[model samples]
Target: MRTKAKRAGIACAISILIAGAAIGAPRDVPTGDGMYANIKTTRGEITVRLEFQKTPMTVCNFVGLAEGTLAAAGGKPFYDGLAFHRVIADFMIQGGDPAGNGSGGPGYKFPDEFDPGLRHDGPGVLSMANAGPGTNGSQFFITHKATPWLDDKHTVFGRVVQGQEVVDAVKQGDKIEKITIVREGAAAKAFKADQASFDAYLKDSGGAAAAKAKARKDADLATIAAKYPQALKTASGMRYLILKKGTGAKPVAGKTVSVNYKGMFLSGETFDASDLHGGPIDFQAGAGRIIPGWEEAVLDMQVGEKRLVVLPPELAYGERGAGGVIPPNAFLVFEMELVKIK
Candidate 1:
C-alpha cells in the first residue's frame, strides 16, 4: 500500500502529465485566476484558488455564478443560508445548495475534467460531486481527509485558502450566508497569501498529509463492498441479522437523509446511536458526509426503510472504538432504520 506521501507524490507526478494547473502555495487562499474571494459565512470567511487554466468550464461555472448577484448570478450562489449539507467530522464538509434544502444543484452536467495532476488528499482540497460519469454540475466537496479515490473520477479545480476552521466549525444545520467570486488579482491573492500561517497549523497537524493507509484499506473494503452481498462474508462464527437491504431510488448525492440506528458492542454494550431528540443525522450520501462505512451501506435503501448491519472490525469503529463501552477491534451489530430519504 502506498503511504500518504507516496500517494501525494504520485498525484503530483500525474498532474504534470495531464497539465492540470498546480498551486504554488499549497496551503494558502488559492492564488489562481478568476477564483472566489470574501466567501463570508456566519461562522467566518474564506477564499478559493481555482484551476480555471485547466478546468475552464467548471471554474467559469462557479465563478460566473458566485460573481453575479442572486438574480444577476443567474440564480443564487447558494440559496438562503444552506448547511454544510454533508459533513463527516474529520473527512469533509460539503454545502452550497441554492435550494435552501440539500436536494439542489446547478441543474446541468458536463464532461469530467480529470486532471491526473490534482488530488483530493490535503485539507481544503475541493472536488466536484457527481452522480456518475460526466455528471458533475454545481455540487462540490471540501476534503478534511486525503481522498485518493477521487484522483481522476471527479474534477478537483480548487482548494480553500483560509478559514478552514470556519469550514470545520460548520454544523449540520449551519447555513452558507453567501459565496462571492473575485478575480485572482488583488482580492484573491490577499486571501491565498494567508496560508503560510495556516500552513504552520497544518504542519503541526501533519501538514497536507492525511491518514492514507486507512484510505487505502478502506478502498480495498470499498471494492469488496461495491460487489456487496456477493462479497459479504458470513464468516465462521457469527450470528447476525440483515436488519435491512436497500435498493431504492438512490439518495441523490447532495440531498439530506434521516436515519435512526442502535449500535452495540460485541459484548452487548451500546456505544453510538442516532435515535435521539436531536433528530436524524441528516447528510448526503457518498460526499464524505458520514463515515465511509455509513456511506456504502445507505445508498441502496429507499425511504421508510431499515437494515441490520453487522460490521466487522474494519467497518465498525476499528481499533479506536468509541471508548469505555466498545473495545478496540470489536465487531458491531446495528439495527438501522431509515426514516426519511429526501
Candidate 2:
C-alpha cells in the first residue's frame, strides 16, 4: 500500500508541472514588412505595426518623437518615462503628455492626417487624441476594444501587432519604460523619421496651400505692425502700445487681476469681447489660465492701464488656434484694460 501511494503522488506532481508549463508558454511575436514600435512598459512590451505609408505625417510625428529625431523633442526621447495618465477598462489607455495631464502637449500642434481604410475595428488600435479637428499633438491612446465612434475623429496611425495583453493590463499612471522603433524590409529601413523628412512629406502632401495661407497671415501682421511704428517690441515677439497709463500698482505673478478686453484679428474684426462675457474676467496672473500674450502684457501694466497688444502665433495659439473664432497660425490683437489687482 505504501509503494502504490508513492507512485500516485509522483504522477500528480508530474501533471502539475505540465500544467504550469502550458500556462507560461511564450506567446508568438508578430512578423511583418513595415515599421514597428516596441513600447516597453512596466507590465510588458507591446509591439505596434505602424501604418507609415497610409498615414505618413502622423507616423512621422510618432517616430520622430519616439527616436528623438524631431526638433520639438529637443534631442531626447519624449516618451521614455511618461505615464499612461488616462486609463479605462475595456476602453483605452492614453498618455504622452509631459505634464501628465490631458491638457498638455509637445508645445506645438499639427493638422490631422487620416486614411479612410483605417478604422477602429478592434482592440489595440493606436490613435491620436485631440481637443478637436486639426489639433493633433503628442498625446495618443490605444483602445482595449472596438471604438467605432472614434472613427474619422481621431487619426489611427497604427495597431498593436503583439502584446495586447500588456495594453489591457496598463492602469492609470503606469510608466512607459521606452519606445524603440524597429524597421523591417528595405522600404522601412530607408524611411527617415526626422524634421526634414516630415517637412518634405508636408511639401509633397499639399503643404503649398498651407504655406500660402501663412504668407498671407504674415503680410497682414506686417501691415498691422507698420501702422504702429512706435509699438514696443519684446524679446518674445510681442508688440504693444500703452494707450493709457495708470497710477495704481502694477500686477505681479500670482496676483488676481480683473481685465476687460476686445480680441480681434489682423483686420480689426472683433472675435471676442469682455462685454459678451457679462464683465471683465478675473484670473490669476502668470498662472497660464490665459494665453501667453495676455500673461506677458498684464505683468507690465498697472491697474486702470489699457494697452493695444499684438500677439504672434507662438504667443497666442501656435498651430492649433482657438475654436472656429481663430484660424490656425493666426496673429491676435487685443485691446486690454487692467481694471483692479487683488
Query: Which candidate's TM-score is highest?
Result: 2
Put down candidate 2 lDDT per residue, 69-113, tens digits, no spaces.
999899999989999999999999999998998998888777777
Clash number by candidate, in order? 13, 0
lDDT of 2 at 200: 81
Q: Which stretches of candidate 2 lie over 4 Å from their true place?
A: 1-29, 204-342
Best candidate, lDDT-wise?
2
TM-score, cand. 2 vs. native: 0.56
Clashing pairs in 2: none
Q: In model 1, how large is the Cα lDDT of residue 290?
A: 62
**RMSD of model 1 against the true structure:** 20.6
Residue-wise lDDT of candidate 1 within 1-342, one digit each (tens)? 569889999999988854422211123445555555455655666576777656655665555556443232364453335667787888887776666455677665555665667888788887887665556656777887788866766789887777676667766666666666656665434432122332343343332124533564466455435534443454432233444555556576767787788786434567767755465777777788565556666665676667666576666666544534554455666666767777
